[model samples]
Target: MSILLIILTIILPPLAVFLQHGLGKDFLINVLLTALGWLPGVIHAFYVNKR
Candidate 1:
């Protein structure tokens, strides 16, 4: 990952996922994860981005 993506992931997980992937399953799931908790969203964003 680049500097911007890492920053976005820490700051806003969903946005990171959106940038890495798009408006699809990963993005939708990241949205939910964010709704649930910031940490979870960040974790999921990292996981999704890894994939």
Candidate 2:
């Protein structure tokens, strides 16, 4: 993951993952995680983006 992506993920988790992976399972998961809690979404976004 790029620095910008990491920064974006911190600010907006779902948007960061969506920009990287688009509308897919990872994106959906991030969205749900984001809805549930900010920290989970950030963690999931980092993991997903790295993968």
Identify the leading candidate in terms of lDDT: 1
Candidate 1 residue spans exceeding 4 A from truth: none
Q: 21 in model 2: Cα distance from truth in Å?
A: 0.6
Residue 28 displacement (Å), model 1: 0.4
Question: What overall lDDT goes with each candidate model?
Answer: 0.92, 0.90
Q: List the residue pairs that clash in candidate 1.
A: none
In terms of lDDT, the poorest run of 10 residues in model 1 is 14-23
TM-score against truth, every candidate: 0.93, 0.91
Q: In model 1, what is the error at residue 35, expressed in angstroms? A: 0.5
Q: Enumerate residue pairs that collide in model 2.
A: none
What's the lDDT for residue 3 in model 1? 87
Residues 1-51 of candidate 1: C-alpha lDDT, one tens digit per residue? 888888999999998999878899999999999999999999999999987
